[model samples]
Target: MLIFIILALIITILVIKKSKTKLQKTLNETVSNLNKTIREKDDIISELSKYQDIIDVQSKCDELLSNAQNEAELIKKRYETLLTFAQIEAEKIKEKSLSAKKQMDEQIKIRKVEYDNILSTALEQSKQIISDANIKAEEIAGDAYKALNNHKELEQKAKAMKNVIEGYGNKYIIPTHGILDELADDFGYAEAGIELKKSRQKSKFMVENGLAAKCDYVENNRKTTAINFVTDAFNGKVDTILSTVKSTNYGVLKQKITDSYILVNNLGEAFRNAVITPEYLQARLDELKWAVAAFELKEKEKEEQRLIKEQIREEERARRDYEKAIKEAAKEEEMLKKLMAKAQLQLQEANDQQKAEYESKLIDLQKKLQEAEEKNQRALSMAQQTKSGHVYIISNVGSFGEDVYKIGMTRRLDPLDRVKELGDASVPFTFDVHSMIFSDDAPKLETELHKIFNKNQVNKVNPKKEFFKVNIKDVKSQIEKMGIQSKWTMLAEAKEYRESLAIENEMKSSEEFAS
Candidate 1:
């Protein structure tokens, strides 16, 4: 029985030991959980502190907003008061302006009435002054006419007496029937008495029957007046003719001369009794003819001078071209010779397969060298021949219109260069070449073409202008007649002009659509 009790005590001690271990573990777990709870509570406190700081900032913002609201309300009230005062002042100013405007309108009406009255009086005075002046002018004109008539009568009598003195002897006496017989019988008495009595009888006869003397005076007056009138008219006409010659074109001058001749002849014929003698009329016509001849000679001389200057300029240009061509040809020939030499050297060192290529290349270089030399020789020949050049027919349809062409000549190696220069900035579009004819006598060919189309020249007054208005067919026919063969381009391709017309039409269409 004591053994069983000792065993029970040992079992009890074991149970107590296990239970105490579990209790100690539970205490440790509780302490760990409490520490974790304290840490979570510290985190919550930190978050709450941050939220408190935000709340404080929000309160400060609220105070600032309230202050701003109060100030805005005060400003709004002050502006309303100012607006009310301004409205009251504006109403007063409008009332005063309306009253002032009414007063000004009344003053303007009174001033306008005074102005009209003054204008009416001035107009009446002006009309009276003009009428009186016209009456005085008529009286003066009538007096002048009377004075002129009296002067003409005196001049007629003087001219008649002068003519009578010139036709007969100044000292010759009139022959009376009985006076001569009486003088033969009583020489001394008859000479004195017969002279007195014959003078009285002559005066009496002139007073009674003066038809012959009156006719002579009238004829003399008519001739003198006609001569004076024609002289003045001729002088005036000559001055006018000279002015016209200077101002008018040469083409119109001949017509002007014909008109003036007819007018002057008609003036001469208008006079009565053959007063303008045929001899005098013919002499005046001869003077006019001489004057016109002199003017024509002067113009011809000027034209010749211009032509000579132009010819000199053309010759100089040709000479320059020739020199340039010779220099260029010499340069090309020298370059070709160097290339041939280099090719020959490469040919000598080439391999069999490469030798064939080099040989072909050498042959090409040799040919080029020969061509260059030939070109140089040709240039020299052309330079030596003064007439060697190219004659070209070209047209600028945009500037000069259709069927008009310029026939020109150039000594340049590339005749197209001259054509390009002719189609420069002076014209809106470039010229289209119709034909380029190379000739040894280019000037002669050009001259022949010009003569054939002389009447068709665009500017007949200036022959230096080479443009002609003729169809391509006519030109070709004339060229064939001159025994020249040429390729002709009958159609002109006015590319830019056509394009401009297209663009213009498109723009007009767009404008019309927009409108």
Candidate 2:
């Protein structure tokens, strides 16, 4: 019985030991599984946790990736905005640059235009100034040249004058002065052979050489010519009248207009004063003597007529008887009555014809007188104006006035000399020198004088003793009252006389006048 109990105990110990070992093994497996579970939990928790953790870790990763995608998209949007703004800024810069270039181009065009206008104006002004300067310079030079030439010409003339003065006179120049103007009148030159030359080219060598103006005197009339013609017609028949008169005597030369012998003294005076020189002086005297001899023969016939005048007592009775016999004839009485009536009618016709002729002649005379008066005016003006470096001698001469005397005379001496000479010549103290009546032809003055006065009437004037010397008396009156200093009163008086007799006055006085 003891042994059975030991075997059972052994079996129980063994089973217990095996069970302990298994339980320990299970505990280790549970611990390891728990560790694995915890790790898994951690892992599961971790695995499941891990799977959950993996799921959790995957969720966290997905969240992180989504956030990154959102950030990238934002970056892309910002880049696009930057690019658009940059493009806008660049476009604005380009436009501004183009505007600046356009402005610069416009300024260049304006500057060019202004420069061109300025250049053109400058050129035009320069050209005008040059042309004007050339014209001015040319004028100045021309004037200068003309002045130089004039100076040279003056010098040459002065030199020539000096040389001419050195020459001699007698053969080259005449000593006489009275013939100087006459020579000039004929030669168409002055005494010096030069027209404008005052100092004769010969005068420089020829001292006291000069000339007086030569004037002419003519009787104003038609009867003078007729009387001259009558003397020629009658030859020696009326030599008494011819001896006292001459073809050349001018102005009033007689004391009275009716004086028959007054012409004698006038003819003699004219002969003495006339320029008769040595050449013709002798011939003139001989001619005058022959005229005187013829006059003596004619005077004898008149003396015989005066002596036979007393023996006419019986002749007067006989003349009455003869006249009665003529009246008694029947045929003679009838013819006488018819003739007397015809003569009366003829006388009336003749008177009417004479009136018409006188009117026509008066008109012609007036026109001729006016023309002559104008020529005299010009001549008088020339006389008053004197040439330089020259002395003039003027005279109012001859019996053509009141006396056979010189009315006026002027010398280079003085006024007192002239007065003395006038007093000596029986000229009035108031008488002044008239003009130096200069003429190229002596006949022209003589002709003009005849146109003014009738030759027979001229011879009747007495210059010293007046009977009807109207012209001489008038001259004296003018000198006394008018206080005129000119000796050329003869010319002036004639002009005044003509003007006073205008057509208006003539028409008033006459019954018939030209319209």
Candidate 3:
């Protein structure tokens, strides 16, 4: 019985131990499954948090896009307003330009009308002059033949011729054997010599009688060639008249113009003995008519000169006035400098107000001194500008012959000394003074005179020659036209030249008789 009970107990114990082992194995498997479940739950929570973050970033991007659209709309509206303003301003500018253009066109038309009126008036005046010339020509033709027929009238004719030829008491006349062209000289002198041979007995008779001077004057003064004489005479007289008309003051210009009309009439009368042909006389008349345009040009030049002189005078006066102001400023500046220096020294002992006053005065004085110095420098620059010089009009008939004069300028105090030097050894005789004009800017005056006679210049190549084949009347006229005050002596008392000419004529007369 004990063995059976022990076996039963062992079996029971084995069964109990097996049940406990099974229970422990089951618990370990459950624990491992629980751990896997926990790990998967944690991964899911981390993925959900990542999705929430993406949602939040998308919301912010959408908000930013909306704000950018709003800003872009604002910028578009602003640009549209600016564009509208620009278009309006552009339209206004276009309208203004067109209006200005129209006004300019209107002014140009007005100027054109004024120019036409001036041209028409000038034409009428020219026609009147031509008519006067024709009437004078008729008078000369009528009086001339009758005068030639009567001996007493011939004496009057001779006196009239002398007055005309010699130019108001032998003033313009040079004691030369006429300023003849080479061809005219060769032909006319030869022809006149032959005629002179025929008139030797008559000349001898006149010499024996008291009519030698008259005969001698006629022979010396008369131009045998008609075309040359009329051309020269008309040119000379017209130039004079033109100069007078252009240069004379308005008060005297009308009288001078009327004198010009009388001059043409007188020219016809004076040259009637020389200019026998109608063709030559017509040419002279035509020349006087053509001279109208020339006169207009000269007047224009004179106006230009007047404007230039006015400008120069204005500049000079401005400079002088400025210089005076600068000197006064300098004087004031000196006074201020001394006052400022005293004030500066006093400032050390003075209070705040006085120190401030001293500094202000010092600054003002420095500014003034600077201005004065600048003005004084400008005055120095102006002082270096064209200084005064002497312009002289002189003639040497023995050297250069009739109607020729020298236009020259010098900076010398005694301009006559220069003239004397010129006449010393280079020329056979001394120079005759027509005038001496002093100018602040002599070069400008000299240049204008040269322009007047550029065509008639003796030495076109050499500016130093300063000689022109122009009459003294022309020179005087040009000078006077320029508003230059000059001491004028019309009498070209060529004493040496006349003596030399007399000696030459005496020798010629002796030779001609002997031959």
Best by lDDT: 1
lDDT for each residue of candidate 2 in 1-515, tens digit (9 for 90 to 100):
87888999999999999999999999999999988767655543433433566778899999999999999999989989998998999899999989989999999999999999999999999999988876777688977755665695456445434434553223322222222323323332222223213322222222212111111225425423433332233223223333453331211111111121222222323432222122122222333333322332233334445434521422333344334433333344455455555555555666765756655554554555455445444333333433211111222233134422233212111234433344464632233343343333323333333333333232332211211223644434544463434344433232333444565587676856543
Greater-lDDT candidate between 1 and 2: 1
Off by over 4 Å in 2: 1-103, 115-515
Question: Candidate 1 on 234-259: residue-level lDDT in tens?
Answer: 44654565465444443333334334
Q: Candidate 2's C-alpha lDDT?
A: 0.42
Ranking by TM-score, best first?
1, 3, 2
Range of the 10 consecutive residues with the lowest summed lDDT in candidate 3:
174-183
> Model 2 Cα RMSD, Å?
46.5
Candidate 3 Cα errors over 4 Å, as ranges: 1-386, 508-515
Q: How many backbone clashes does candidate 2 have?
A: 51
How would you order the candidates by lDDT, starting with the best?
A: 1, 3, 2
Q: What's the TM-score of each model vs. the native?
A: 0.49, 0.15, 0.26
Clashing pairs in 1: none
RMSD of each: 31.0, 46.5, 32.2
lDDT, candidate 3, 1-515, per-residue tens: 99999999999999989988998899889999999999999999887987997899899999999999999999999999999999999999999999999999999999999999999999999999988876777688876645455666446455545555554432332211122222242343345445434444443444344332211124443533333444445445534654553333322332333333334434445444433233333333333323333443344456667867864764555456556765875676687678768877887888977888877877886787687777666555444555566689899988888888899876544568668878997679999988888877877888888888899999753445689898778778777787777789887888999999899999999999999
